[model samples]
Target: MKKNILLIGGSYGIGLELVKQLSEDYSVYVASRTSEGLEGTSATHITFDANTDSLDITALPNEIHGFAYCPGSINLKPFKMMSLDTFESDMQLNFFNMVKIVKDTLPLMTAGGAIVLFSTVAVGSGMPYHTSVAAAKGAVEGFAKALAAEYAPNIRVNVIAPSLVNTPLAKRLLSNDKKIEMMSQRHPLKRIGEVEDIANTAAFLLCEKSSWITGQVIGVDGGMSTLNLS
Candidate 1:
């Protein structure tokens, strides 16, 4: 039987890639705020808005094999200039919204089902102008671990913390050649990340091959998180 997997916020970027790749082998259900005319013939698109306080969980399947929360924010600004509303908004989108979705979908997840969430390398290692996003993603890391521990032997939870991926979300950071070169040089790999780099990891985690992994924060940042080629 094809594994039933639901990808939230999968209209574009890594989420879109996952839907495309996974649809080849698994049944994929995509949910996002706005409808996306995705080209995957095998995937199903569902109307979902994470910002809404009231959501109908019954709209989803009764048994889900995997779930990926792909919603995120790239708000990078100085701490002094950032307002509380900005911080709260980021947290709501990246952390709290994910929490609500997982809670509502818990009953639908089969035994051994997994959950994957996106974070940023800034959450672990400090970065300038990343206070709001870092704080929000930091909460996701915490949530993943706690849920992983609590649901051990039944469900798996993991996070992918990436740096400078070339997605629409990061386009502003790499719009100009100078900006692109600056970001590329910051990492030991000498280039920003690609969506495939992260999407592949998501597919692995959702599949049975990574059944043993849980509560882990895997960094797909091209050696930026751990390596220093000085």
Candidate 2:
């Protein structure tokens, strides 16, 4: 039987790649604000907006084998210039919304199910101008660990923290050749990440290969978080 999975924010970026990979074997349902009609032949696309509302999981399959929350922001600003609202907005989008979605869908994800959430390398190794995003993603990291422990022997929850990736959201950061070169050099691997890099890790976490792993914040970055040579 094909496993049923729900992918929130799956229109583009890492989420879209996930839909593509997972759809090869498992049945995938994509929900996103901008996703109109289904783009690929494998997955089913549905209209959804995480910032304003929650998904209607009641209409979904009872056996939800996998779930992933992929909506996030790169709101990097100086601490002196940041406002309380900015922090709140990031928290709402990155952390709180995911909690709501997971809470709503937990019933369907019985034992053996897996939930994958996105984080950033900034959460583990802090960088300048990352206070807001790091705080938000830090909460997600902490939540994943706690939830994994609480739901032990049943559902599995894990996180993937990636470094700079070539995505529409990251276009501004890597708009020019100079910026791309500089960013690539910062990582130990000497190359910035591609969407498929993170997508493949997500596929592993959702598959039976990683069945024993939970509450892990796997770094998909190009050795940015761990290794450094200067």
Candidate 3:
């Protein structure tokens, strides 16, 4: 039987791209609120809403080889403008939901299994108006590191911290050519990240190639987290 990979949200953007790329090599199962952008792929889709529903493991294999939590938020607002509810909402979606998924899936994961979580560049780079998202993603990073340590020699866990990828989640930021160019120029790479850029890293992390790598927060950003080219 093929190794099974359970993805929490693979219906759009980087998650969708990862599902498409991993389907050829693994049995891909995607649980998301909608199955948009997954047309013609070999991935199996199960209707799920992370906010309102729990993952049904009946669709997963008895031995899960890989898992990825692809759900995240990019709530940006100044400290004073951000409400307590805004922070709570971000924590609920980005932090709590991931913890829930991992606990629910840990039992079925096989030895050497990999768990990939999503974070944001803002978590380490400290950009303004990123308090909400950064806090939430920071929790993801911390959780991934601790989980990796406790589950070492069996299940490897890692987090991908990406900068402003051109996904539907960021449509407002990259709406026009002028805005796109302006945002792209902010990064040292001089271009925004494409879905493939992030997906490729995720694919590698989920495969046997990254067996020795664990407890790492890999930066798939366009050199934004560490580089300052002024």
Candidate 4:
């Protein structure tokens, strides 16, 4: 039997791309509210909503080799216009729920298992209209590092902090050619991140190739975090 990998959200975007890449080599299990875009993958789909429902652990394999949480939000609003509740909501979706899932399912992982989480480039680089999400994702980055230290040599934990990508989650930002061009120019790469860019790195982290890596936040940004070419 192949190794099992559980993903919290794999219906679309980077998660779906990772599912497509990993299912070929591992037994992929995806837990999401809808099986939309997963119609033909070899993955086992479980209906789950992180906002309200716990993972249907009964549907998972006895042992899980990897896990990734892919659900995220891109709330770009002025700080003052946004209330405290806005920040809390981002925390609930991005940090608290992930913590609950990992804690609940970690028992299924023994040694050499990898856990992947998502953050944002804004977490490290201060961007206007990103205060709420940046705070939330900052918590995620901090949590991943601590978790990795605690579980070192047993389970590997890492984070992927990405810049804007051309995913459904960012459709509004890159809706048109002019907007796409503007966003692209902000990065040294001069192009927005593709789902594959993030997913490929994610797949590597989950596999034995990255066996020695953990307790780190890998930037998958398009050189936006560290680049100054004027």
Each prediction's RMSD over C-alphas, in Å, is 1.2, 1.2, 0.8, 0.7
Candidate 1 structure quality by residue, lDDT tens digits, 114-159: 9999999998899999999999999999999999999998999999
lDDT of 2 by residue, 53-155 (tens): 6687765877899999999999888999988899999999999999999999898896899999999999999899999999999999999999999998798
* Model 1: lDDT of residue 140: 96
Candidate 3 TM-score versus the reference: 0.98
Q: Model 3, 119: alpha-carbon shift in Å?
A: 0.5
Off by over 4 Å in 3: none
Residue-level lDDT tens digits of model 3 in 1-230: 67999999899989999998899899999999998678899898999988889889887778889999988887788899999999999999999988998999999999989999999999899899999999999999999999999999999999999998999899989899999999999999999999999999999999999988999999999899888877
Superposed model 2: Cα runs more than 4 Å off: 36-38
* Over 4 Å off, model 1: none
What are the per-model numbers of colliding residue pairs? Answer: 0, 0, 0, 0
Q: Please give the distance, in angstroms, between residue 156's alpha carbon in candidate 3 and its true position after superposition.
A: 0.3
Top lDDT hit: 4
The TM-score between candidate 1 and the true structure equals: 0.96
lDDT of 3 at 50: 88
- TM-score between model 4 and native: 0.99
Give TM-scores for every candidate, taking all chains together and pairing residue i with residue i: 0.96, 0.97, 0.98, 0.99
lDDT of 1: 0.89
